[model samples]
Target: MSIELDHTIVPSYDKLASAKLLAELLGVPWSPTALGPFAPVFVNEGLTLDFIQTDEDFPVYHFCFRVSQQTFDDILGRIKRAGISYRSSVRGPVDMRINTDYGGNMIYWNEPDGHQWEMLTVSYARQSA
Candidate 1:
């Protein structure tokens, strides 16, 4: 049997706004769907980013998206248009920059909920010996 990720719970102070922001940034469709006490944002056909409203402090999570070159360009353009600050690396200086590491373009930014989000055009692969 193959293993695949179905869904994940993302804690946010404002579920709807956070979900909407993510959807718009990623150019993905999202809708409000009641899932128990959580409001889920369906990022794709196979992945659901469930936003759980919370008041207590929680650890910030990092999410990465592997996208095509065109998709990456579109998203990056949107980000720049929105005046969203991005960085070449997680700990690097904040600026509108993209890293050409691993022979792929990558940029890092944070959502409304302060979740670290990364978009890359290529996936990092390990060479077999």
Candidate 2:
């Protein structure tokens, strides 16, 4: 059998609001559904981001999306319009800057839960040392 990522549970203080924010930023559809006590945000047909309401602080995670050029531009524009802080590097200065390090344009931002989100226009294979 082939392997694929089906879904993931994202812990959030306010699951609905967090899911909505992610959906809006990624230009995806999200709604409250009965799925094992999760506020699922459907990113695509087979992939779902399930947001679970939690009181305890969870470790922040990084999520990256490989998108088209147009989508990248649109998301970046939305990020700027929403006044979301972004950076070219992981721990770099906070700005609306994009990096072209991996042969593609990439930008990083964080969600309300401090989860790092990344969008890139191209996929660069890892280089050997």
Candidate 3:
């Protein structure tokens, strides 16, 4: 049997809003409430992001999604149309640029809860391995 990531709990100040926003941006389905007070975003058939409400402080996490060039373009367009600021580099300023240094298009943006979301057309991590 092969191991795969099934789900993850994402801490959020407002679980519903956060999950909804990510779902809309990724063109995925999200449920306002799921088992045990979770606002779940169905990322795909195999993975789900369960947004949970939290008041305490938590470190922001970085999540990267590798997609085809067309999907990347579509997501980027939605980000732009929604007035979301994005940067080419992970820690770079929001120049609204896409990084091609990794042999593919990549961009990064932060959600309201400060979690970093990344989208790339190619898998640089896979290439290095």
Candidate 4:
């Protein structure tokens, strides 16, 4: 048997706007009310990000998406066009730079809710088969 991640709940100040922004940047499909009180962004056929509105304090999270080179370029272009700041290092300041130290392109950006979002071409954290 095989198990896969189906979906995750993302805490957001504005679920609609957050889900919409991520969907637009990733060029994915999303619905404001796909489910009860949650906005869903379809990352792919297998996975979905369900954004839920929250007012109480919540810890910021880090999300990493491994993408193809072309997809990375396209998403990065959209992020840039949206004027979102990005950095090469996860904890570094926004320098509008992409990191290639892992033999592939990678960048990190923070959403309005302070959740760190990452996109990379290669799986630096994956183990070799």
Write model 4 residue lDDT over 1-129, tens digit each, in one string.
589999999999999999999999999999986749899999999999999999989999999999999999999999999999999999998899999998899999999999999999988999357
- Candidate 2 local Cα displacement, residue 52, angstroms: 0.4
User: Residue by residue across 45-74, what tens digits does model 3's lDDT show?
Assistant: 999999999999999999999988988988
Q: What's model 1's overall lDDT?
A: 0.86
State the TM-score for model 1.
Answer: 0.90
- Each prediction's whole-model lDDT (CA): 0.86, 0.87, 0.94, 0.95
For residue 3, give model 3's deviation from the true position in Å: 0.9
Off by over 4 Å in 3: none
Among these predicted structures, which one has the highest lDDT? 4
Off by over 4 Å in 2: 125-129
Clashing pairs in 1: none
Clashing pairs in 2: none
Instruction: Write model 1 residue lDDT over 1-42, tens digit each, in one string.
Output: 778799999999998888888888888877766757677777
Q: Lowest-scoring 10 consecutive residues by lDDT in candidate 2?
A: 120-129
For residue 82, what is the lDDT in candidate 2?
Answer: 86
Judged by lDDT relative to the true structure, which candidate is superior, 2 or 4? 4
Report clashes for each candidate as comma-separated counts: 0, 0, 0, 0
